[model samples]
Structure formats: structure tokens, C-alpha cells
Target: MVKQKSLTNDNTTKVEFNNSVQTIDKSICDDVNDTVIANGMHLRHTMLTLNSFRFTTQLLRSLLMGFILLTSLNTKQLAQSSNLFNRNTRPSIECLKNDRFYRDPNRPVHKIWTNIECSKYFLCLDGDVFEFKCSEGLLFDVVRQICDFKQNVDNCDITADDAVNFENFDLYTQILFSPNNRNPNGCPIKGTFFVSHQYTNYQFVQKLWNDGHEISVHSVTHRGPEIWWSKNATIEDWFDEMVGQANILNRFANIRMEDIRGMRVPFLRIGWNRQFLMMKEFGFVYDASMVAPFSNPPLWPYTLDFKMPHTCTGQNCPSRSYPGIWEIVINQLEVGDFTCGMIDSCPSQLNGDDVYRMLSHNFKRHYLSNRAPFGLYFHATWFNNNNYLEAFLRFMDDLQKLSDVYFVTQQQVIQWMRRPKITPHLNTFDPWGCKPRQWESPEVACSIPNTCKLRSRVLQQDRYLYTCNECPTQYPWIRNEFGLD
Candidate 1:
């Protein structure tokens, strides 16, 4: 006689014949045809009449084959679905070859290009391909080459659900220049200069500060092998590089230490936590070395209280929190197809009209959207190009026509961010308004600026020191910032 065991709650079926029991897990055979289950039942019933062992063996083998076949088919379907998804997401090798930045050979080869969606990017390593996706609400920034806020990624179609809706906000523009070498030509047409001590004209720096343009530190040496700042620089190295320049500025330029509130690292290569720790330890309020992604509603200058909202494309970006020190992001400007971190690096082939259009297009991206501060970072050499200079002037002239657009300094931008006000209140904004220049000492204009030729401790070479104040005994390099021989 044959008897059927009750199915367990787990959906396991048991069939018994002549003191032998065979268990079939319905979970495995759930997708198997109903005929397969019915045939098994019929074999068990026939066992009662025929009482044969061979028939029962055949029934178990047939059921096992069905489970294997169904599992194989399901696995094949899943593989096809996975392949389809990869085909859609992965960028073609041809696409990478065509990318101007990718083909340049100057950029890092590993993270060369982004997929069309901008939500993911491809990594090429040793003939193998790997893919990475940004976190939720972020997109790949092709310019800065990092995962950034959705609004900051150009060509990214991803919608930011949590984006702050800024309405009727006035546009504030900040122009910053990091002048590494000294020239008789004082300030450029517009913008503040973050002067390095190497070849800087202290008198000219003082004049710029007095003229109400911001004077921030670049570095004492501004030494090259630019990668050193991001890779090998220790906390002490940053202090000497930045604070050393501040000392020189204060002693020679007569600019107060307290007034030198900002700095831009040489080559925009940040030293991650070491850099920020140095800034926080000292009194520096901001650093403008970090680059923001190119987006319509651009990223605003932000403090380091929380984890960075954008990707750290600077390589060794800070992992820990730095509460008060602000990051004045170098929001990139979009040119024809590519983007540039600094205005000068944009297409030099562009005519005056092309330059104007490029500037206007990038400016409107900020003006029409969240009104984050539009930054035009440049070096003094950029203005040497007549085309760029003319176009830039035209662009600024057009911007001046707008009642709401205000050209402020980096310090003023931070102040506004601290106590934000609407467009109506901007005209009367105290921070944006200039304060009277309170000189600590009588202004001493060296009729004949003292030009001292001193031997550099680090470079071990004769360096020219130009300043309104008395020249140092030795060339002020990194470690010997005071130039005390």
C-alpha cells in the first residue's frame, strides 16, 4: 500500500511506498510543470499495484531533471537581463577615444570618461574595464572628474529631489586671481589677487588691499613638482607654505595678519586633512583650491562641518570634519564642449565675441538658477591675451547692466553666506559695502623700491627680493620665511 505524507509548512512534499519515503521540495520545483508533480503521484500509486523498485527510481530521476532544467532556464534569463543592463550603462571605447580630455594624455587614464547618464563612470586599468556609480542625488562631473551634486554636473539628466528652490535671489560674482610672480602692472582690470611672496611686489599688494580688492596669500615659495602639495606635504609643510607667505605679506606689504583671511594652494593641489588642519589651527577663514563641478545651479561656497557634499577629485581630500573653515569652490566655466577650472585655461583660439559668449553662457547658468556666487578665477598672465581681456571687459559690462548682479570679494561672499539676505536687502548689505581703510602705520611709499639680491636657503640660488619695506637679510623661502640669515 502507498500513503501520501502531509506537506510541511515549508512546502516540502513527501510520498511513501512500502516503508520507503521520497521527499520533494516544492520550493525547488515551484516553477516546474504541474504534470511533473502529477506524474510523481501516479508513480507512487502504481507502486502499490506493481510493487516495483525500478519504477520509483525512474520517477525520482525525472523530477530531478525538471528542477535542473528549470533552474538552468532561469539562470539563462537572468544572465540575458544582466547583459542588457550592462550594454545600456557601459560607455563604448569609441566614446572614450573621441573625448578631448581623455585623448590629451595629461589627465589620469584610470578615470577618463563618464557614461551618457552621468550617474556612472568607467575605469580603465590594465586592459580590463570597471564601472562605478555615484551615490544617490549625485552625478559624475566630467570637468572636475568627480562625483558631484546633480546641479553641478553638466549634461546630467538626473533630477535632484532634495534641491533647494531658490527664488528671486540676487547673483553675486567673485573674481579671484592667484599671482605667483611680480609685475609692474598692479591689479588686473577686475578681481582680487592672492599673491605669493616669491616675486610679489609688496607695495603693489598694499595698493590693491587699499583699493578695496581682497589680498589673500598664495604661498611663500609656490614651489613646483605640483604633485608634492597633494601627495607628500605634511601639516607642517602647509603651515610654512601658507603662514610663511602671510608673515611676509604682513611684514613687507603692511597688510595685517588678521586681514589675510584666505589662501589658494599652489597649482590648486590640496593636501587634504593636513591642509585644512593647518588652516583651522591658524586663523585662515577660507581656501579656494578646490574645484566644483560645472552645473546650471552651481555649488555654493560651503563650510566643512559635514562630509563633503561633492566628490574629492583633488585626490587627498579631507575625510574628517572641519567645522568653520570655508571652501571657496572653483566652479568651472563651460566653453564650447569642454569645461575649464580657470578662465584663462579656456580656449585661447576664441575670438572676442566667442569669449564674451562663453563668459555670458556660464554666468547665466548661475544667474538664472540658484544664484550661487559666479567665480572667475584667473592668473595675471591671462589678461596678456588681447582677445580674452576685451571679451572679459565686454562680459563684465553686460553684467553691470543688471541691477541685481554684484561683484564682491571672497571674504564678502563668506560673510553673505553666514547671514543670507534676499535681493532687496543686498544694496544695503553691510558686508558687501566697503569699510574705511584703517592703516596701522603711516603709509610708506618707497620712491625707489628696495630691490635686494639674496641667496635662497632652499633653492641655493641668488633670488631678487622686491619690497617697499626694507628687504630681508636672506631670500624668504619655505622654512626660512622670515629670511633671517
Candidate 2:
């Protein structure tokens, strides 16, 4: 047996062997039979042997030529099949050597990102680029470079069946409130607060904690040039912001440090892989700062195993996988008639009615979609406006009337996603409704007294000084740093 090698159109070389053992046996048998018959007879066998030998020789030659032609045809067929397979099955960008460019030629090589929508691939071979489209209804996703459905492009390893369970009959809503500045009264009028250190009043934060509202850290400074600051911040910086915030609350506010489970970047500017690594190291469960408009029904809480399907709208988005760290994406909001991702960026001049309409529209987007948890992500600034405040309060009141809706925290929503169960009714879900709890101090007196004002001479002070307005007259027990009576 002899092996033959052939190159296919796809630039792959395949090895084949000549399988003509039967042909060779038949040729040898015919020659031996002709020789034996010639030996049995003398005179007549001599001439007959000559004719027989000639016929046998010609037959062997013909068989040899036929086998050669057969081998050639088989080689050609194998090559053709290889080419067909290469063409029909989409090859990833990896098939093309040094091919960094996507479909667009204008964008820089580094800037062009692959998504689930990639259906075609350009093979850069031999100093020429050849384009190959994926087989019908599939797109060539740049991240993975394989042809897949648009919905499956995120590469989260989620199945279509995982999108929604009609039998479940429930949906979720989570509030991720970024408290950019502290409230003077220390009590959040609405939603959970991501308190900044500048205005942090532990007593008020404790009230929020006791009320079952989530308390997440939003850096100490909540500094300017948000993206640059977050992107450049290190693990030490995050520790000071989050762990430090926890320490302040524990020492003064009496809030447990272990209770803080999540965090959001100050400006939704992801700190890339480093931030997630920091979260995983510090025992944090999730981060809700990511914006994912590319996701259709919005992505559920997924670990950092594969490339996220959503567009990385914010700076320094995570590029590598960080196991066990979950991302609670910020779904875009549907403003009155227009859709916007950020609440602050929603169409301006929206009165209370328009705000209510926008919230309703956004609520439906999640309700009708995969039932992924909807997020009401906003800063406290939005609530400062009377119209916006009234509209939000009204919306919540209206939302509570609906049986399926749940206004929970990010941590609570993620808990359900991890251990999901189908129920006949929405109320059956745990953490759906709240029960009353005892407060350390009465709600009316949650804030410090009017006579005692918060004063901090330095920026890095851990606790605020409760300075007596009328010196020794008010708060007679309190003393200054110098211990003056």
C-alpha cells in the first residue's frame, strides 16, 4: 500500500492510500492459471501459452491503469468534500491569519469588537482578504468567531429555554440607587442609597439598613472625571472606598460590616477585570454598574465565564473572564416615547405624567421580555425635583397594585436567579413582601437632633463631630476635642 497526499482548497492537506489489493491478486491468479494450462500440453500449449500470456499481460496493464484512475478520482472527491465543509461551516476569524479587522474598514483594529451579529468572516491569506458568510440565519460573532444566533451571541452559555418560563408567573424589579451626595437628614426618602463618605451619616444609613433597603458603597470621593478616575483606581483604592465605608458604618452607625453584599462603580465606568477581581477577593457577590443595551430581553445575572453579549458602553469594560463574579446589568429605560439607557439621560422636560408613562413603558419591556429583573437605576439628584419625586412615588404606588411586580434589592434578585423556582402565584416567592421590624431609634428621631450639627474639619475624618449649637447649654454631656466644659 502506498499513501498519497493532496492539498484541498481550504489549505488543508489530507493523506489517502491506494486500496487495490484485490486487483493485484486477480492479475497474479490469471497469470498463474495461464502458465499451468500451457505446461499441461506441449505443442498446442506452446502457442496457446503465447496468446494466454499476451492476454494476461494486457489485462494486468489495463487493471493497473484503471486503479490509478480510480485513486485519482477518489482524491479529487475527498478534496471537493473538504472544500464544501470549509465553505458551509463558518470559520472563525482565527482561520484568517493576522485578521484583526471586522466588516468595517474605518474603525481601528484595536477598537473593532466582535459581537453575536458577526455572520461573515474575512480570511487574510497570502496578502489578500477573502470574505466568507455563515450558513443561513447565522452571524459570525467576533468574540468567539463562530456562527451563531443573534440571541446566543453573548456566549453566556444560556439556553433558549432559559430565557423565560411561562409557567413561572413572576417577575422582579430591583432598585440600584447611587447616592452621589449625602442627605442632610440621613434618611433616604426613597430607594436604597450608595452613600458617599462626604455626607455619610451612619445613623441614617442604619435606618435604611434596618428598613430592609440595600446599602452599597459608592466611593469615598465620588470624584470628578468619573471614567478616568474609576478606570485608573486600584484594588487599594476600592478597598478604601468600600471596606473603609463599611468600617465607618460599623464603628459609629452600628451597621454590620458583613451585611454589605454589592457595589456599583461611581459613574457606571467599569474598572475592567481588576474591579471584578477585587470584588471576588473582598467577598462581594455582585456589581450592578454595567449597561447592556445590546441584550434583547436583557441578560440575567451571569458569571464572567465568556464574553458578555451586550455592548460595552462604559469605559474599561471587563474583557477577560472572572469566575464567580456576577454582573447585574443596567437595562435601558423607555422614556415616555423614547428609549434611553440612563435614567438621568431620559428625555428632558418630562412632567410627572411623562415620568409615570416612562416607568410604565420600561416595566412592560421587562415584563413582556424574558422576565429578567428590571432595574430602576438613578442618582438621588433625580429625586430632588418635586415633579420627578412625585412621579416616582406615584409609580411605585401604582406598581404595588400589580400582583406580579416585585420591588427588591439587587442582592435579592440575584438570590432568586441562583435558586429559581416556579410558583403558581408571585406572592409565593420568598422576599416578595416585607414584614415590619423594630428600629433602634424611633423613625421620627432617626437623624441627629437639631441642636447637634455634623461638623468635620478635615476631609478624611472617619466620624462627624456632633457640635452643640449652644455650647454647654445644649448637649451638656458633649465635649470638644480640647475637653472644654
Candidate 3:
């Protein structure tokens, strides 16, 4: 038996075999360099001893074959080590140089990339790179370009066991009632009224908020031809229309800005990426506008970090990614052979039993399958039909009997998406539990609300503003969101 010792330095490895010694330089074997350095010394001694003994040509050939086999094993080990090193290494900030935004300052500044570990992301802005870390238990989603729950990002090292198990058959239901007009007479059964500042009873809106219903923005002017939202609307148009409504709801209805977390595009006319861009910048959590195909397993709400999973059914579906903004798809309801995007658009002629059957049929598709959040999205005008209203109430009553069904607001649904819970544990979920309203001012309550009439330059007529607080000199509209005179 030969005693062997090996020593490694920056550029070479020295090996001593008994009294014989040899040094292997790093440059000779680039692919198998590390392996050679580790075992070359011991193998060198064996070759030398065999050579001195005048070994047969066949024996020497066999010895050479053994050495080749040893090198192959070492090569595999070295390759695995290299891969491990790459995984552990933090990606360089210079990696941003490959992005178009870094190369061209005129390009959009929304460029983002993640480290190999997916624990943090790097944002490129004005040719500079900035690092940001994901929240606890979350990972940087490369597809969506935002920090998200671990289960949503496919490449994450974490297991999906932490997510809510779908086998439990839990169904979350959300009702999104968008009232575009504030008519004093209330929503008409026939047609929508003109958008008004006055008729919306602020006290009633406040009561809804108080009752734990989510107050989401529809639009300040729900103006139409309907094509404007899908075609001519710009990002600024969305900011004014949606954000302006939110401002009015906050000032008059006393709904907190943080609580108003969602928006539905007028007429379900998606403004492509424009509306989503505004939603992301303005802290809105989700958009319940885009329509999905009427499929058996309906589409679930998903983040805009990657391309949309379904085809763009409505006009101008978002083509760009708007990370962190959730898209609650309006999975179409089947009525006979046709499908309607909004539940209200479904045949209103149906009897009470028929209405119940239609809703139950569509709902079971989600309930029996992936258990995606089922939505009942409609305008308040839909309730004007007595049969439709009665059947909807009956449907709600039936759903309440299920131990696993929960009727939640859109904001609450988004919260559940972030941290999902199994049916058994959902009872303790904090987001669903109602708490007392946190009013910014004590004047949020109004025993006698003020009705202010102000001249509007845009409308060229007097506009009404009903509020619990002091009325502004001018009624709030598009650019004049705060109702400043």
C-alpha cells in the first residue's frame, strides 16, 4: 500500500506518493481540473510503480482505463458542486445591464429581476440598480415581477404543503355590486341613470361600509358609448375616473382609503394595460373587470406578473404585466346555450326556480373543481326584478347551510388569496372577521347630511354633492377630484 498526501494552492496541486512526488498545474485540465488536483497524486504513484516493475502492455492499458474511470467520477462530483455554488450565489446587480430599461433610459422604468434564491428582487431605474427583499414567507415571483405567496411561484424551492389544500371543498363567494349612478330615486329597473354627485345618499353608503361591505370604485363619470374604456382611455383617464370615485366615497361616505381596494371597469370594458397601470400605482389591490371563458373549471383570480392564462375575451385585455395587482376574472355564467359576463345580463325572463338553477349550475363548476373564488358580479339595478332578487336571496340562504362556504367582500377575497386557509382553519381567518371602523375624523357620522349644490363648469349646470362632512365649493368631478372651487 502506498501512502499518499495532497496539497492544493491557487494555481497548482502537489501530491506525494510514498517517496515519489508530482505537481499538477491548474491550466492543463480546464474541465476536470479540480478532480485531477484531488486524485492525480495517488494515481501518479501507481503508474510510476507499475512502470518500474516493467508491467505488461496489457496491464498498463488496464491501469490507464481505471484512471479514466476515476476522472469521470470526479467530473460528475465537480459539476454538482459548481451547480450548488451557482444556486447559493447572489445574482449580480450588473445583471440589470441585460434589461432594455437599463440600456435605454427612455424605456419604461418597471424593469425587475430576482436573485437565484428568489428571496429578493432588483429594480432597474435610470441606469441604476436597487435591491428589495420579499416579505416573510413570500418569494419574489419572476413571472409577475412582484413578491408573492410561495405557492404561486413555480420555481421557488419551498413546497406547496403550506398552502390551503384544495381537497377540502371550501368555496369562497364574493358579491361585487357596482352602482355607476347616484340617482335619488335609486337604481331604476329599466336603464341606468346619469352619473350624479347629489343623489347618492352618503349616509346609506356609510351604512354599507359600516356593515362590513367593501366599497369599491366604479367610475366618477360612467360615461359611455362604452368603447372609450377599451379604446380611447389613457392611463390618466383611468386615474381620474377610478381614483376620483374613491375620493368621493372617502370624503362623503366616510369609507377609508385603505378599505376601498378594488375597481370594475365601466361596462366590463377593460382598458387594457392602462387601467391596471393606474391600479398598481394607486395602491388598489385588484380589478374585477376582465371576462373569462365559460369553462367547466372556471379561471381563478391571478396576479398580473405573467401573461394571462386565458384568452383576452373582452376588448383590450392587458398585454403588459402589472405585478402585485390581482385580476379577479368575471367567469361568465351559462344561460341556455349563451354565456353572459355579468350575472345581471343573464336572461331576466327566467322564473325563480330557473334563476336558482342557473346560479347553482355555474357555481358547482367552481365548487366541485378547483374551488376558485366564485363571484356574483352585477349592478344594483339587477335587483329591481322581484323574481331575480328573490331567487338570489334563496341562493344565498342555501349557500349559508354549507359548513365550508363563505360570503366575503372582494378585498377579503384578495386577502384570502395572499394567505389561503383550509376550510377547517378558515373560521379563525382574521381578514374575514369584521372589526369597528377606524375613522380618520369623528365627523364621519351624519345624523343630518348636507346637500350642497354647486355650479359645474364641465357639465355646464349645477351639480349636487351629498356629504356627511362640510361640502366643497364645487362638486367633485374628473380633474377636480377634491371638489375645489
Candidate 4:
């Protein structure tokens, strides 16, 4: 029988056949047939071993190629991951350029800067400098450069702007009540009272504050020749009256000093330059003494950077600019076709029906036009009469009946003016409109099982008309004070 041996070279396998005595042919069929016949198992074993080695060599080659490809992939993944980490961990840069351009280097922030031209302001918010554009119809007043009513801007076509769509907007209303009267017995009165040295019902003011009603300063001493609020008063005089009033409210009414953001001139007569300067210095955000809406459609609240908009009907409107201080103009109440700011200034005394018509008409003006804020400006004396009181109540109830109508405070109105929510995208704006509030119950304030005798009377002392009343003094309802016998 022949014996066979296998040899391996660097790249190939070779098979040799031989006998015990002499070499034979390399073909297994010729030289190894005897071995296959005599020792079949050995021949079978050699053949099987050769086949297994060949298969194993092919598998190892495949595995080596796979390992090289996997290593290349892992290195690329590591490099890509390093780049991603660097991008996410890098420092942010804030660049403040030019006099009008600024960037906050430590954080992502935007800022507004005033330019040398009063009418042209620059905003550096989105890493770019851009001029502010007013809403349709308004023009930039060069004196102060803020968007203002067209009447104040010379050579501008007021008629060229597109009208605001009321269908897409919500009606915003604010009631401005100047606490000019003091309660006689340190109790909240039901009717009209002026700020006197006699007494202040801190409880009433507290209720107003808690109920979301804005209580603004008229004057600490609301006593008037009406001339004190004219241009004749100095800045010191205006400060003593306006700021003094705020101090009194904060001290006595538990109202935050910063919360009092609005004021009205005594008798609706502005102290002009001095009053505005004092307001800016005293942290007051807006003033409600101006009466320009009588001649034009109501305008949104604007800063006093330019001349007063509309006709400066009140005495000595400020000629100088008070930047950043807002003028909350009193949009006139419409009585039939005529328009007036003061409730009493209407042609004649309005009954409940006239009052309702007047208010509804005035509201339509704002609801129809640019959707400017609607104001119901009045002294407590006007509401003292049952005719006006019931009418005012009806007006308020009617307002509450309408959808998307909010009877908010003046400060709230100013906030909306600054950031208008007129777009259809803001369908949920002013969510607090007529929401039920936890106010003191009428029975608690007025009726307490005969322990308190609620009475109201109209008393005229000198030229002023006021309503006087007596109550339990603990929980008194100022409105119900006069209605009771």
C-alpha cells in the first residue's frame, strides 16, 4: 500500500503519495488505491482532514477581512462623535456692536437701543439691526420716533393705512376710578366720595385691588381750583400730589407701590411738562388725563415722545417729550353722534337707555377700527346717581355677555397694547375675561341680620356733590350703601 503525506506552502497546499520502499505517482487513484483497499479508514481519514483544513483556511481569510472593515468603521464613528460633542459644548458669543447695536456675550438675549434720531429706534435682538415698524396707519414721530396717531405726524397720509379687522380681535375695556373721596367713618362708602382729610376706607381699596380693579392716584388732596393741575404747577408740586397719592395708597391700602402704574390729572386738566416728568421719575408707567379721542378714533396707548396726538383739548398739554412713559388717552364716550371723554361732558344727562347706547356705540368704535382699548372714565360722583349707577351696571353686564370681551385694568390694557394679541394664532388671549372671582359676598358687606343699618344719602357740600352713608363698618358694600333705606 502507498502512504500519502500533505505539505503546505505559503499560498497553497500540496499532496504527495509514496510507498514504504519507493515513491509512486502523485495521483491518489494510481498510487493510493492499494491503501484505500487495504486500509480504507486511514485513506478516508486523510481525505477528510485535507478537506477540513481547506474550509478552515477560507473561513479565517473571511474573518480577517471583516475585522479590518469593522476597525475602519469604529475609527470613523469615534471621529464623528468627537465633532458632534465639540459643536454642542462650544461657548456662545454675544456681540454688542455700534452705539445702537449690542450683544450679550454670555447668553442668548436681545436688546433695544435708541438712536440719535428720536423717531428712529433700532432693535438688536436677532443678531441683526432693524428699525421698528408701526402697525398699519401709524407713523413714526421724528420728535420721539415712536409709532403715534397719524394726526400728530406731519405730511403723513392718515387715510392710507389698512383698517384693523375687528372680527379677528378681542375687545379690551378698562375702567379708571380715581379715589378722590375719603369715607367719613373709615368705612367703604357706596357712592361718590372725594379724597378728604376725613377718612379712607382701606377695606374698599383692598377689595378693588383684590378683585383685579386698578386703583390709580388722582391726588392725595383732590381739592381743586382745577388750576393746580394746569401748567402752572412745578415738577415738585406734581410729584407731591401724584407720588404723595401713591405713597398714601401703598401705606394705607396695602397696595404695592410698584402696582400703582397709572394716574389722572386733577379735573382732567394736565400739569403738562411737569406732570409727565414727575411720572417718569416716580415709576408711573402711564397717564390717563389726556382727552384726544374726542376728535379722532381711539388710539392705542403711546409713549409721549412726540407732540400730543389729536387735539390737546385739556389745559397745557406737554410740549416736551417724556420717553418710556405711556399716555393712556381717554377714548371719548359716544352719546348718539357726539363724542366726549367726561361722562358729564355729554350734551345732556343720559338715562339708562342713553348710557347703554352711548357705551355700546363707543365700544363699536374700538371694535370696528384699529381695536384700540376702550376706556370708561368717570369720577365717583357721576356714578352716585341711581340713573348712572344702574346704567353703568347694565353696560358692564352687557359687556360681560359678549364673547372675547375683557373688562381689565388700565395696566393690563397697557400691557396688551405693548404686545397686541390680535392675531388669529392667539385664540386663547385674555383668558380671564369675566371669569368668576372670589369677591366678598354682598350680604357680608351690606346686610348682616339687622346688626347693620345700611343707608345712603346724596350730600352737597360747597361745589362738590357726594353720597354719604353708614354701615356695619366692618364689611361694607360701597355700591349698596346708597340703595338701602
Q: How much lDDT does each candidate structure score?
A: 0.61, 0.50, 0.58, 0.47
Number of the top-ranking candidate, with lDDT as the measure: 1
- The C-alpha local distance difference test score for the whole of candidate 1 amounts to 0.61
**Residue pairs in candidate 2 whose N, alpha carbon or C atoms collide under 3 angstroms:** 118-139, 118-140, 119-139, 119-140, 154-309
Residue 403 in model 4: lDDT: 50
Q: For model 3, how big is the CA root-mean-square deviation?
A: 23.7
Give the better candidate number (1 or 3) by TM-score: 1
Count backbone clashes in candidate 4.
Answer: 13
Could you estimate the TM-score for every candidate? 0.60, 0.52, 0.58, 0.48
Alpha carbon lDDT at 307, candidate 1 = 78
Cα RMSDs of all predictions?
21.2, 25.4, 23.7, 33.2
lDDT per residue for candidate 2 within 1-485, as digits (tens), equals 22323344533323232342222334343454445333432323332333334344333333322222222122333222211112222243333344332342322333333432244444443343444444454444444444545454432121211111111111111232223211222222234456554434345555556656777766554544465445677777676666665554454445555667777776677887678777878887778777776446666777777787666764688778877777888777755346666676787788888888888877777789888887787655565567887787677767656555655677777767777756444345554444555554433224452223332222111122232122222111111222133
Question: What lDDT score goes with residue 64 in model 3?
Answer: 30
Model 1 agreement with the true structure over 203-244: per-residue lDDT tens digits: 666656665667788876565447878989888989888998
TM-score between model 3 and native:
0.58
User: How much is 369 displaced in model 4, in angstroms?
Assistant: 2.0
If both were scored by lDDT, which would come out higher, candidate 2 or candidate 3?
Answer: 3
TM-score of 1: 0.60
For lDDT, candidate 1 versus 4, the one ahead is 1
Q: Candidate 2 — what's its lDDT?
A: 0.50
